[model samples]
Target: MSLLNDPCATPAELADRCEEAGLDLAAAPTSSDLEAVGAFMAQWRRVVACSEHEPRAATLNALMLEYASAPWLTDHAGTGWHLHFREPDVDVPRQIAALISVGTALHLSGLGMDRLGICAAGECSKAYADISRNGRQRYCSTTCANREAVRRHRATRASATV
Candidate 1:
């Protein structure tokens, strides 16, 4: 959400966010790297836009087919063995695309296809993953939810006064 929603985000910002998410960036990202990932993020948005499960699953499957490699286990850093769905020694953008594609697949399959969506807030098109206990999320954040709630309350009050 942070990366996709920030249209002005730079390569340095992408590097920072990737580190925060525990992604192993082999080197500092370049503008081209960020652009590549941004391109992939656009395709990922198609999955979020689907109102029905079937389309969502199909879009995600296509992304996985394009980005993800066959699953493998590696201890590249000697820390511990971990599963990777991308080719070994891939660059930042390719690595990110592969990870996000496979991760979204695992998430939706484990949860539900409706788990990803665009925020219901009228003014926001931010994408969100519904990982809540009940899987009924409608807004991207509490701020958006509260803003919509306040808008509704004010509209109701004005209509009642009229």
Candidate 2:
């Protein structure tokens, strides 16, 4: 499921990761800064994986600065039961981190810690939220499935030709 599904939960880093994965973003990421984004995504991968392995606030804090104060609640009206995590004016990164971290916490505690995962393709490293009825989604998309299938097919044919 798109992390944006949880309007309040989509943290900046998560949004960045989603953007990197070509999911969604308010603006297109600059190609020049891709390396910096890659660094953050690596940490984000750790954060998502930590829920199963070793979820620690210290580790999370090391990845990014902590929220300066407890996030306040704001209701934008008619948006249903969700909370805004930032002050009306704040840096986007901090705002995003708070939203994403809170969203992730809510997601893990409310649903289950095991609901997040990386795609299972051999060379793919995309993240995904298992929001299916059975929560069995593994690959990021059907394209990955097709690619892997083609790879295997080619390998089989190459061996046969040899």
Candidate 3:
């Protein structure tokens, strides 16, 4: 979502964003890495915007096929044998893409594909993953919801006065 909202325009920015997102890169990002990350972000936007389950699943499957390798158990950093969905020694951008694609599939399948959405506020284009208990989230934040409510209230008053 961060990439969709504010895409990294350069290799340096991509490296920074990766670091910020808690990805430990084996080395600094390259131009190829930037291109790969940009492409993945575009695909991610499509996945989040899809309102139906089948299309979203298809997209995720394609992504996994292209970016992910066979799953493996690793304790690369002595972190106690966590599962990695990509092959060893993969580049940073490809690794992140694979992880995200697989994670999205799990999240959607477990939590319902409807949990992913773009905010309903007319002025906002933000994407959200609905983690709420009831899974009925519409707007991205309270501010947007409040703004929409105020607009509705004003419209009601105007209609009554007419």
Candidate 4:
């Protein structure tokens, strides 16, 4: 389980997290992978904006009322104490948005807003959560890192040749 904590999380799980964060980027996905990539960016933006702006409960309340429905409370199994933020019966979209709004607030306030970020690849635009020892992750994957290295090396060689 990624627990929404791991930075280098897998693509499949990333898709779920993206949806949970109110991202629906399947405008016309050529493939599932593209959809995943789009959703990841959307979720990343949401996390970044929330962290940077530090939205208040009232702001989230407005979003919930507009995009979602009135927030509700439901606890199942009662493992100690926790809140669901929305009724489980609510439609998936609203439920997801509500949770994303409130859950993101919790994550930013509890953790740190400087936790999320995009890949450092020259051309790639993937997102990450920076769970490193020094919290300095840059690239989305090893493939992107290699691609960037190749690009830089090729550019250097071309410049030398020129």
Locate the minimum summed-lDDT window of 10 residues in model 3. Answer: 18-27
lDDT of 2 by residue, 57-128 (tens): 455555444543455565445445455654555544444455565666667556666677777789977777
Candidate 4 colliding pairs, count: 1
RMSD after CA superposition, every candidate: 1.5, 7.6, 1.7, 8.7
TM-score of 1: 0.92
Distance from true position, residue 89, model 4, in Å?
3.0
Q: Give the per-residue lDDT digits (tens) of candidate 4, residues 27-140.
A: 222344444444443543555434344454445455545444444554354443455566555443444456555655565456555655566786765556555666565677
TM accuracy, model 4: 0.49
Task: Name the regions of candidate 1 deviating beyond 4 angstroms.
Answer: none
Q: What's the CA RMSD of model 1 in angstroms?
A: 1.5
> Which prediction has more favorable lDDT, 3 or 4?
3
Query: By summed lDDT, which 10 consecutive residues of candidate 4 come out lowest?
Result: 1-10
Candidates sorted on lDDT, descending: 1, 3, 2, 4
Off by over 4 Å in 3: none
Residue 120, model 4: lDDT of: 74
Greater-lDDT candidate between 1 and 4 = 1
What TM-score does structure 2 among the candidates reach?
Answer: 0.55
Count of clashes, each model: 0, 2, 0, 1
Local accuracy of candidate 3 as per-residue lDDT tens digits, 43-137: 88899898988988898899999988788898887758788888888887888798788888888889988988899999899987788999998
Poorest lDDT segment (10 consecutive residues) of candidate 1: 1-10
